[model samples]
Target chain A: MRNRFNEQLEQLNVELIKMGALCEEAISAATKAYVEGDRELGERARSLEQDIDHKERDIESQCMKLLLRQQPVAKDLRAVSAALRMISDMERIGDQAADIAEIARYMEKSAILRQVPMEEMALAAIKMVTDSVDSFVRGDLALAHSVIAQDDQVDSLFLSVREKLTALIAGGENGGLCLDLLMIAKYFERIGDHACNIAQWVEYAITGDYEDD
Target chain B: MRNRFNEQLEQLNVELIKMGALCEEAISAATKAYVEGDRELGERARSLEQDIDHKERDIESQCMKLLLRQQPVAKDLRAVSAALRMISDMERIGDQAADIAEIARYMEKSAILRQVPMEEMALAAIKMVTDSVDSFVRGDLALAHSVIAQDDQVDSLFLSVREKLTALIAGGENGGLCLDLLMIAKYFERIGDHACNIAQWVEYAITGDYEDD
Candidate 1:
């Protein structure tokens, strides 16, 4: 019975890794879609979001079953519960990626990417999401803390993007386009925040406490 | 033992209600600060967010204890887990309200409220938050659905606010102020989304399945 429970926990971890990879793929495709003005890539990201959503539900049920059947305690219980919280953040990252894709699909023009630091910011956010999940998978405390620290970089990028867009608007650029760019930047910032949340949960699972606590 | 578990569950419910009430107060105070240019009210909202955060930690531990100690099955498990999810959304509502208040504090001039549908939108969001939590406490599916439907109203109000703000900016109004107002509108829209999330969880707890599932 103990061996079976261990196997199931391992399976849960595999499922979480898969979900995290899906989120990474979704965000990467969405960012590529925005950069290349490709609606097909955006559509691909949306499809990935559906898959991610299914994975979330599947993994959530697995966690619930582990808790109910195995009645995991101490560190094992923390790991399972933390997985539950981490997946929600992962699912939100997928949703935000889809949101970014949706915005990309609606962009009548795509020059905003060239005019702002959005590409770099998106990449930073993507790295944060990927590394945070990786840290969770490996229980790497240092990597998790690094992911948390990278959030400031993403935030600074957002502010810079905002400043650039504001300057464009002040210079009589199309306000609608600038607003769209700002929204995209904001979405990337939010993705960073969600990634930070995942890292904090990772910390909790491994160390039995969050950074703030 | 069963009666003791029920008592603890009731205490969890009461704590959730208190947290929901804090969310309502935070949003209300923030909106009032925006409307009246009252920095003190904004400060009050910010302070309330700290209380809301503390309540979230308290309620979260309670749910965790109930799950671990009682090992509740079926509906009882659902109720405890649902409370876990609901508190996260409620905490987000508080954060968004604090975000709005932060923007309000920076608004040196507050005539923007008179220029847009922000007041109505803020009020609508507050109603959704209150109704969603009430639905959760009472296990009212119909009320949950009602709260979900009201999200469209808040969304539409957001579009209207954007249009009005865009018109003002196009008419050579202060771009910075218009942008700040737009940010405030977006925060309210997010509050509505969080409320919708809470309502969905409420539905899940009561029906054993989410609406989409």
Candidate 2:
């Protein structure tokens, strides 16, 4: 029974990594869609969200079954609880990706967004999301802490983008398009926050410390 | 040993509720300071935040001790985990209240604002938070769900406040004051989100569903 449980646990971790990869891809695609105004990419992300949701549920149910059947103690108990917390963060990340895609779709026809730094902020956030998940998979606590440290960069970039958008709006250019772009920038900033949230959870899982990053 | 553990669990719950009440009061005072341009109230809210932070750390340590001692299972496990999660939400709520107080301090001595509805929205949020903590204490899942449901009202009120502020800015009026007000409204909305988070945890502890609010 213990052997079978170990096998199941390994499989679940593998599935979680797969889910994390999909989440990264979704965030990447959504950011690229925002920059290139790619409607199809946004559509792809929306459709892929259902897969992410399904995977979240699958991992959760597996964790629940493992907890009930194995009644894991000590480290095993920590792993299962970590998985549970991580899934919640991952699912929220998926939702933020969909929100980004929706904003991309809204901006598909907007011509007033040229020269804005919103796209740059989105790319930075996507990179953070990818790095955070990679750190989790590698169980690299230092890397996770580094990702958490970069949250301030994303926040500053967001403020810069918002200021730029506000200036454009105030200057009587790109009136309607500025709002959509602003919302997209906000979504990217929020995605970065969620990424930081996941990195914090990863740190907690590994070190049993919930200290604020 | 089991009886001792249960007693500790009860004490933790009581302290968590006490901390929640402090946060609720801070949010309310901060909002009122914004509406009334009362720096005194803002200072009071800011002063109370440190106590909330101290309470949060205390409860976290207590819960850690309980987990180490009891290695609780099933419903007891859920209760302890719920306490941990609740403190996290409560801490964030404390931060949100502080955010509001900061904004209020920034707006102190400014001209009287025309948007009175912000006060109403903040009041509604405070009520939701109070009821959310009450529901947790009483184990009233329905009441918690209702608090979650009221989140939409807070959100809508936030949007309306934003629209009004934007209109004021677009009309070439003094935007500094309006923007500060908007930030206060945003803080209240976030406090509402934290309240919803707490309610979700309450529901999860009861049902283990972990469904979105």
Q: Which candidate's DockQ is highest?
A: 1
lDDT of 2 at A82: 72
Best by lDDT: 1
* Candidate 1, B1-213: lDDT as tens digits: 899999999999999999999999999999999888888999999999999989988998888788878889889998988898888888888888998999888876856569798999999999999999999888899999999899999999988988887677676666667667878898999999999999999998998887641
lDDT of 2 by residue, A36-146 (tens): 879899887877787788898789668766766676766666667777667766776787788788867865465566667776787788777887788877889888888
Question: B39-116 in candidate 2: lDDT tens per residue?
Answer: 888887887787787897788668656665666777777777777777777776787787788877765464436543
**B186 in model 1: Cα distance from truth in Å?**
1.2
Worst 10 residues of 2 chain B by lDDT: B107-116
Q: Please report, in order, the local distance difference test score of every candidate based on alpha carbons.
A: 0.88, 0.76
- Candidate 2: Cα lDDT at A15: 85
- Candidate topping TM-score: 1
TM-score of each: 0.96, 0.79
Where model 2 places Cα greater than 4 Å from the true spot, the runs are: A1-12, A32-85, A102-109, A173-183, A204-210, B1-8, B36-84, B105-112, B174-183, B207-211
For candidate 1, give the docking quality class from DockQ: acceptable
Q: Individual DockQ of the candidates? A: 0.49, 0.17
Show pairs that collide, candidate 2.
none
